[model samples]
Target chain A: MSKVYTGASMSLDGYIAGPGESGFDHLFEWYFNGDVEVPTASDMTFKLSRASADYLTGYISQTGSLVVGRRLFDLVKGWGGRHPLDRTVVVLTHSVPEGWAPADENFVFVTEGIEAAVAKAAEIAGDQVVGVNGGTIARQCLDAGLLDEVWVDLVPVLLGSGTPFFEQLGTAPVLLDGPVSIVPGDRVTHLRYEVRK
Target chain B: MSKVYTGASMSLDGYIAGPGESGFDHLFEWYFNGDVEVPTASDMTFKLSRASADYLTGYISQTGSLVVGRRLFDLVKGWGGRHPLDRTVVVLTHSVPEGWAPADENFVFVTEGIEAAVAKAAEIAGDQVVGVNGGTIARQCLDAGLLDEVWVDLVPVLLGSGTPFFEQLGTAPVLLDGPVSIVPGDRVTHLRYEVRK
Candidate 1:
């Protein structure tokens, strides 16, 4: 009953990132025209976080528990120690930081696989969809056939190469249920799709 | 007062196409879900064409002139002579195609400088926007500051690298009128941005 949603931006030719992730700055520089309409809630430091929040709220009103990868966790941590998620956030990783747990009340560092993490999140999420927020975790869910929906915000910039969010997928085709388009501003495009086996 | 509405997809770190364009397939693949509730009009091919039409029509709807790069012209020609734009299509190139004329007063070929072709397109489009369909010509317009607007439907796949759609561009920034997100099915996410400045 719980739907897993995967989302990210890609290139015109279908690449997630270029070699060593070069040219990202160039691409960002091209599309990095900051939104002129200022947000009423947050500053630019967590602009992406703010955007992601808008995305998460759309499907699952509130994620009882959220999960992320270690790298992504660290990135979020680096954002001036801002834990944007209001609910429990389980960082799925092997290594746990010394003082990371002290950062928040709902933050949990889990070494278990995505399934275990999702199971835990679902217990807390109840009837709501379990929000999977990391690239690796989302792909793992997709591979495991656990995701019920995918929301990709495909930004219109291409990085010649880098760490691809989604790579070689399973042979079996995944079907669509419904697709909708939303415009946050003239800069960001939101594409939501329901997944089917 | 031509507004350049630019559109393209980038990675999390922000790269348009990876070094060699290896990841473009994923981006294209995301758009296709065999099953979905979307109207047939929202098909991938139709949406791509419509976005181009919308951006072009926003400017020169009255004129039926199109300016594309030779590569695009060749690419389209290979598709069983299915020319999407049946107007005066000026293929901007040094090498002119032999016996290539206006396809029933709708498609015309031009092998020359971009300025002449676009100027002619402006004449033909009259109050309509000259629909620039190819990446090279689009980039040329961007570099020359001639493009009024660009409508980019950023897909959710990243090509680590490829022949960049905007390789000629430096670190120039464009204004985002904002973007709309269209998620069709589970894989494809379409984002359209209105070009400003």
Candidate 2:
């Protein structure tokens, strides 16, 4: 079965983005310096180390679809109608735009709820991993016990306040196992873990 | 010259301790389990790998003194009057307890302020590294640009809400350099960073 996972690059203070920051440029600056080699779904340039690049390459290759939030979809203007992952993108929202048009056969918008969105994404993903993006969507999946893994690229900056990566789950503490891999990049530390059953 | 550094074991969510938790038993549980070798001043039994033990042994041998918050000092009952670091411990507070006796001529309570506590700690630290403890004190020192390095043992736990390790600094983002070393212990990943000047 395909595993469901979430990933993001966050600051030392666990902020995915700083206040008033529209994009993740600052949080992801480490990827652009042309030193490390990591495969990203976006067109943004990145320099990732061989290990990081290999890991990302494997991750992207294994990801069959992605689930994201409407806010994120709007931030990048629907990723110019094509997401970087090149996989089918499922956008979870309260309501679909009246004149929404599919940029490609891969873009999907679900208004019912995160479960429906994830279900649709999983269906599309088949035996491939389903990737969850956006902190809100990720948290929702985590709360629902629908996520299987979490990957984080820890940037060494204290944003102090911004969009927190983790919110109140209202559930008992979640235990994660294995930083299966801890890759030290030039400006980021990559950590991977499997959600304990 | 002695460098002032802050260190703590934090959750992936950036919480130093869970809500209502009195001690770091959960976060530092890995240290208590005899497995990886790490140097500690306390006689508490430990099982450490040669590398981790060496690293810790070197670290403890170089630490000259420690600065901690009153709350933490009270929590451990001043580590039983003598701290594990085996170095002078300065407790920062607003007032000193009446008739407070020196735990062993090494415990000092500074009612003046963080500056005074840190200054006194530095004096005792001399050319050896000065260690700062507690989230509040560490944040204060970081904000004041008095901290030179930070070492964190990242534990894989989602403390939905708790005592956050980093708080709003009300200043621009503070950059850090290095994971100088990333040691994946049985239950924790140890990370070291040099605070960028």
Candidate 3:
């Protein structure tokens, strides 16, 4: 059975994206600029410690598929049909975009809902892990009790206002099992929590 | 010299207090309920591990004074004149409360502003640590560049909508130092960060 998890780089103030900012420049600078020690599959160089590199590479290698929201898909312009993760990508949206033809056959579009998209991703993932991207998509999975884990790379900068990762989740409170891991990176702290049933 | 620090128990969603709730009932349950292991002074019983108890008690013992917002002060009714930390409490507000009389002589009401309240608290704190309580007070201190550290006990429950600790901080971004420490409690994860100068 594949577990569904969410991974995002968020500000200490709980924002995934800041106002008037594009390309998640500040949020992802640590990864691309070699500020933190993380393992990368590409030829890009990183300045991470050997231990951190190993841990990050290990985590990334386990992802078998990804489920993304329409907002994130549009922001990245569908990743030009291929993603660095080298896994199947499922986009959850209301309607398919016009002339949405990808050079790669791994892109999937699910219009039913988040649950259906997650189900499709999990099916494609098989025994591996299904990674959920974007805050809204993760929140939807969380509300439906479909998420197994939430990994947050808490950045040091505070973006006063922008896209908040957690919105009005209604009346009932959602509980997490444990902060199983808290790893410190260059300017970010990586926190992992298990979403309890 | 005394350093100013802000501390609060917040939801993973970054809320300090929930709607229609008072006295931080949900946030401080672990401390009052003895859910985790913690050391107690004066023979007070705690259900926390010795290490956890020591860490918590040690942190509590370091506070010489506290700066709180008017809203939080009203919610706790000024803690009935006595606070659990046994430190001087300064309430920041526009005007003094009517018929304000605390049984303890440690309570002081500062009507000028957050800066004045903090200055007064720092004077009283002297060579000890001045603890800032409540979201508004902390935010004021953060914006004014008066805070030294921020300790957050990240509770697992998500409140969706409530009193958010971090709000629109204007154009400039406030950066924090490393999460210096991340300690996992029974139902909470304690994180400590130094406010960058």
Candidate 4:
């Protein structure tokens, strides 16, 4: 079975995006601060520290599918129909958007909810990990007990206010286990934690 | 000159405290979860992991004084009149409390402003570091261009919602220099980032 996980580059104040959809320039600075090249499946390429390059490439290689929220899907226009990771993306939404369908252009819409979407993503992922978006979708997966891990690229900037990493959690205090891996990168700390079963 | 810095044990979701003033049990778990002893000036002694103990002891051993907001001074009843760290505390408030006075029982009340409070604290600290409380006091120091560093004991739990660290910044996206030190403890990662001057 594919391991289900969620991750994001969160600011020091725990925001994934600052208020009014801002602060990406600071939160994602690590991707552009160093000299080593870490290219996506598409045109975007990241200049990262050697350590980040090693960690990111390994992460990208292991992720086979992603389960994201409709909000994110709409935000990037479905990642231009091909996710930067070049994997199958299962979008959990109330209804499928117009002009997009199932399993075409690397996008799959799931109206059945988080469980069904994650299940489909895991099936598509096979042995690879199912990467889910942080915040809303991640909270749903966590609440449903389908989430196995939480990976965070902790950026150093304090966003002050913005969209927090996981908001409105069903559980008040969600205690997690070891950040099994702590890979220090430029301007970001790649921390991977195991969700308590 | 005393180096000004602010720190707190923050949740993975970037909250210093959870909603309704909750979540300290999860946030301060690292302080009580270790075998090595790190004693403070007061009767309170923390059992910390060796790394955390060393890091914390070194942090505590430096000659210091704390500058904090009136709200925090009132919160713990002035840490029971003697702060756990056993250092002089400068309370920044609009007016001194009804009973407390200057230079008495390790507590000094400063009603002037953030600058005067920090200045008094710095005078007391001398060559040592002048520590500021996170959140309100820290924000003032940063805005005043007085804060030099940020120390965070990053815990693994996600509080979801609560008092965020450095809530409002006069300057958005305050760029920091480095986590010059990263010490991993049993359940906490002690991170120190230098504030850009």
How many angstroms is residue A106 displaced in model 2 relative to the true structure, after the best TM-score fit? 2.5
lDDT of each: 0.51, 0.79, 0.75, 0.87
Cα lDDT tens digits for candidate 3, A49-161: 44345556767788889999888789878766666666788989888877774323678888999888988888888888999974778888888888899888788777777
Each prediction's TM-score versus the true structure: 0.61, 0.91, 0.89, 0.96
Which prediction has more favorable lDDT, 2 or 4? Answer: 4
| Better model by lDDT: candidate 1 vs candidate 2 | 2
**Runs in model 2 with CA error above 4 Å?**
A22-25, A35-43, A47-49, A101-104, B22-25, B36-43, B47-52, B101-104
Question: Per-residue alpha-carbon lDDT of model 1 for B1-197, expressed as tens digits?
Answer: 22333344433223344555445454444333343222221122423333333433333334356677777667557233433434455567776566655333544555557677677677766655576753577778766767755544444333323445555453333343434334332343344444444
lDDT of 4 at B109: 89
Q: Could you tell me the lDDT of residue A171 within candidate 1?
A: 29
DockQ for all models, in order?
Answer: 0.10, 0.65, 0.59, 0.75
Q: What TM-score does candidate 4 get on C-alpha atoms?
A: 0.96
Docking class of 3: medium
Model 2, span B60-120: residue lDDT tens: 7888999998888877876766787678898898777566763347688888888888888
Q: After superposition, how far is residue A1 of candidate 3 from its true place, in Å?
A: 4.3
Judge candidate 3 at residue A91 and give its lDDT. Answer: 89
Give the C-alpha lDDT of model 3: 0.75
Number of backbone collisions per candidate: 98, 12, 7, 0
Candidate 3 pairs with clashing backbones? A37-A48, B36-B48, B37-B48, B37-B49, B38-B48, B38-B53, B39-B53
